[model samples]
Target chain A: MPANTLTDMILGFSVIIGILFLYILSLTLRFKQEKRKASLKNRRNIA
Target chain B: MINKPKLLTVFDILTALTLLGALALILFWTPVEITMGPVQKVFYFHVSAAWAGMLAFVAAGAAGAGYLITRKLHWDWVSLSAVEVGLVFGLIAILSGMIWAQPIWNTWWVWEPRLTTTAIMELIYLAYFILRSSLETPEKRARLSAVFAIISVITVPLTFFSIRLFRTIHPVVIAPGGGDSAFSMTPCMLRAFLISLGVFTILLVDLFWHRYRLAKLNYKNQTGEN
Candidate 1:
């Protein structure tokens, strides 16, 4: 029988997918913060 | 300025769906190897991630060249974005490779040529960020980083060729026949491997585009210009 490497496989994929998800999350959060700051700057300029 | 393009939205959806499909195909459709079992599944994505990471570095170098020629900040943005995205994929490749190695090579790390070269390559590109952050002027930052990006791309080929050139335990997947280090994939495995590569390429492009947009936004915000 093939060795039970299923756990290793799971760990590998989790790290891969988890890292990607974290990056996506970071991008979304940074974009939001930047957008808010830009909008607030525009508001202050208009006043 | 904050309004995102519809095309990017479409790309986002496409990337997500194709990635999910690729994962499903890898896990469900591909047959486990008789010798390596489930952990062998890691090879497909691991190699693909490494390929994507190398491609990113190549893109960064080309973009660096573009900036040097045109003296355009947009090309610098592209180069910066590629490096940022490349670092993430590189991290994924190294981490996944380590995870897979634990089961196969029976070790968490090895000082083999491939691994050593890859670590060096990653560090070299990572210095791009530190170099950028240190420069006060945008123009100076772009010029210096562009030069650094161009010079550091040498590591990509060094890391890639390390396996073929050196007698390392890292498997020679493409053009196999590095003696015991070669891995001859079956047709199904080859299909999944090719598809994984394609999916990862798409993912790289999507992430690079997003980063490019973020760079553009950051520039606009800091300069108070549209």
Candidate 2:
């Protein structure tokens, strides 16, 4: 419970949260990319 | 548009709740180690994340086997999704372990078997992505990646056991002194540990599902684009 080791705690949580955030961001990016592809396909069909 | 599964939505909420609960428990509820102190708390999640990441690698191998035998796109997607998730979580495990090690071991890294094997495994899986990206055809990409997945998985157990056996000689501090102490767990710590595992597993499933869906969509679009 020493104050010194608190840095590791912060670093650990930062890793956990940072990885989650990166995955979520990745999901959003992929979703958008897929959406664009789908929409473009639809426009081509309409044409 | 595909309907989001009701169960997965429920899982997302459950995952969030349990993970938050586990974090609170670790940060507030558990007794600080008398010697190692607060930083030791990271050990729980570090070990759990490493375990789950290993499991994900195994899942990728299974997916790869199914794909090779059945030649199903779904199986390929599963393998690919697992690889991606495994990479993310694996990196987390390594980083967290290193962070914990810096203080306890007085070294940021060691040339020990466990760390070395894990690093090698990460590189192998990372190369899977690079290989997939280089290919233009979906069928060839899937086939090649599947083969790589299965081959790469064989290294995981080798990595684990190699580390275990090597640890016996070096007698690292992190290694539990004996079988009984290794198995020993207080009820509170057990609860917190299990809860964290459950949350991480749920989170993995959710991410895999979402990634697979995106892959499916991408595949469909690619076919249509052709």
Model 2: lDDT of residue A41: 83
- Residue pairs whose backbone atoms clash in candidate 1: none
> How well is each residue in B1-226 modelled by candidate 2, as lDDT tens digits?
4456788789778777877888888999987766666887887787777777888899999999999899988898899989888888888889988887888788888888878888999999999999999999988998999999999997789766775666532223234565421434567877777877887887788888888888788888878843
Candidate 1: misplaced stretches above 4 Å? B176-180
What lDDT score is found at residue A42 in candidate 2?
Answer: 86
lDDT of 2 at A23: 86
Off by over 4 Å in 2: A1-3, B1-3, B168-177, B180-184
The DockQ value obtained for model 2 is 0.62
Best candidate, lDDT-wise?
1
